[model samples]
Target: MNRKRLEQILDVSLTMFREKGFDDTSVMDICNACGITKPTFYKYVNSKEELLRHYYDGALETLIQAMDEHEPSNDYVALIWIGLSMTASRSIDLGPDLLSKYMILNFHEHTVTARYSAGGKQRTVEAIRKAQEAGQIRNLCDPEKLFMALKNLSLGLTLKWIMTKGSFPFFSHYGRMVEDIILPDYDTVLKQTGVDHRKKTG
Candidate 1:
C-alpha cells in the first residue's frame, strides 16, 4: 500500500467523521474528500469502521512512541501519569463527540481498539516489572493488577470527561490524582528517575 495515500485517506475520513458524525459519513463522501474513487478507498480500508479503528490505533501508537522517547529510569507510575495526561489532552483536541465515539468503539473486543488497548497494558506491565526490579516500585503487590487498576482509572476519568462535554480539567485533575492519590511519592521518584513529565511534544 502507498503509505502517504493511506494517511491522506485516514485524515480525510477523520475530518468527515468529525464534521458529519460517523453514522452520517459514507465511503463515497470520504472518497470525494480525498479525491479518490470508492474502489481506491476500499483498497486501503474495508469499511468506515475500519477507518475509525485506524485512527485510534494510530493515536495509541503515537502515545507509545512518546512514552518510549520520554521513559524515565523505569518509573512506571510516572509514565502512566504522563500517558493518561497526554491522552486526555489529545481527546480534548479530537473534541468530545468524536472522543466519545472512539471510547464506545474501544469497548468492543474485535477491533484495533482492543489490540491497542492490550498492547498498551502489556507495555505498562513491562515498565512495572522494570521499576520493581530497580526498587523504584514496591513489589508487594502484583504488577499486573496495579497496572490494570491505573489503566482502568484513567479510562474511567477520560470517559467521564467526555460525557461531561469537556467541562472538566482532565489533564490537570489527573495530574493531581496521581500526586495525591495514586502515587503520593510521585515527585520524589520523578526526581530520582530524572524524567521530565511536562515536556511531551507532538
Candidate 2:
C-alpha cells in the first residue's frame, strides 16, 4: 500500500465528509476527489466506513494530550472535567453530521465507535487510576469502570447533541456527568483548588 496515497485519500475523504456530509458522500465520490479508482480505494481500506474509523484512530491521542496538559497538579478531579469539556468542544467543532455516520454503524456492527469511541480505552483508564490513587476520585470503583463511565457519558451526550440538531449543550452536560460519576466520594479532595490549568500554556 502506498502510504502517501493513503494519506491523500484520508485527507480528501475527511474534507468531503466535512463539506458534503458523510452519508451523502459515496466511495466513488471519495475516489473521484482523490483521483483514485475503486480498486485503489479498496487497497487502503475495506469500505468508506472503515476509512472514517481511521479518523478516530487519532482521537485517543488527542484526548490524551488534552488530559496531559493539566498533569502534575493535585487537582486531578478538575483536570478530568477539563479534559471532558475540551473533547466535547472539539466534537462540536467537528460537526454532528460527520459523527452521526459512525453512530449509526456503531449501533449494529460495534466497530470503531464501539471500541475506540466507547470501550477498551486503556489510556483513559490509566488517567482515572492516577486520580483514584491520589484520592481525587472515588477509589471504590475500579479505574476500568470509571473509564467506561467516561465513554458512556461521551457517547450518550454526543448522540443527544447530534439528535438535537446541534442545540444541545454538550460541554456543560458532559461536565456535569464527569462531576457526578468521577468526582470524589468525600469533600476533602474537592478542596484542592489550584490555577485553572486549562488556561496554562505549556
Candidate 3:
C-alpha cells in the first residue's frame, strides 16, 4: 500500500477502535469504514489488537515527546504539570474507549507503563531536587511520596473523568488544581512565612 493509504487506514481504525473498543471492533469494521476489503486491511495490520496497540503506543510516544520538550524552571513541578496537562488533553481527544482499552490491556505490561512508572518517578525526583536547590519547594516531603501524590492525583482525575462519561473538562480544571498543589503563588508562600515581599524582590 502507498503511504497516504496506510495513514488513512490507521486514522479510520483508531476512530473505530475508539468508538467500539478493541475486542468489539473487527477487521470487517475497519475495511468497511475504509472502503477496502478484508485482504487489504490484513495487508496493513495482522489483527485489530495490533492496531489498538499501535495507536495507544503512538499516543504515549506523543506524551513522552511533550515531557522531553518541557524546560525546567524554579517551579519545575508546575512546569511538568503543564506539560502533563497538555498530554492529557491530547490523549482525551483520542477517545475514551481507546483510553480505557489502554488502561485495561497495557496498564501494567507496556513500555508506556515503564515510562509512566519508572521514568515519571525519576523525573519527579529530579524536579524536586532542582526545587530544593532553588529553595523554592519545601524539602520536608520525600521525593517518592511527592511523586506518588502527584501521580495519584492525575490518575484519580482521569479515572473520574472516565467514570463520569466525560462530564468534566478534566485537563483544563485539573491542571489548575495540580498547579495550586505543586506550586502555589510564591508571594503567598513568602507572606505566610512572615517575609515581607515589599522589602525584598517585591
My TM-score estimates for the predictions, one after another, are 0.74, 0.73, 0.65
Model 2 shows how many backbone clashes? 0
Which candidate do you rate higher for lDDT, 1 or 3?
1
Candidate 3 achieves a global lDDT of 0.62
* lDDT value, residue 133 of candidate 1: 61
Off-target runs (Cα >4 Å) in candidate 3 are 1-6, 17-25, 35-46, 58-69, 72-75, 106-117, 183-185, 188-202
lDDT score, candidate 2: 0.69
RMSD of 3: 6.1
| True lDDT of residue 138, candidate 3 | 51
Candidate 1: give the clashing pairs: none
Question: Lowest-lDDT window of 10 residues in candidate 2?
Answer: 193-202
Q: What local lDDT score does residue 159 receive in model 1, on the 0 to 100 scale? A: 78
| Local distance difference test values of all predictions, in order | 0.67, 0.69, 0.62
**Predicted candidate 1 versus true structure: per-residue lDDT over 1-202, tens digit per residue:** 8999999998888888888988899888888889999899889998776675565546568768878976854666666655555544555667777777776666664343332266566676676666566555554367678766666666678778888997987767766655443433434455777655445310
Worst-scoring 10-residue span by lDDT in model 3: 189-198
Clashes of each: 0, 0, 0
- Superior by lDDT: candidate 1 or candidate 2: 2
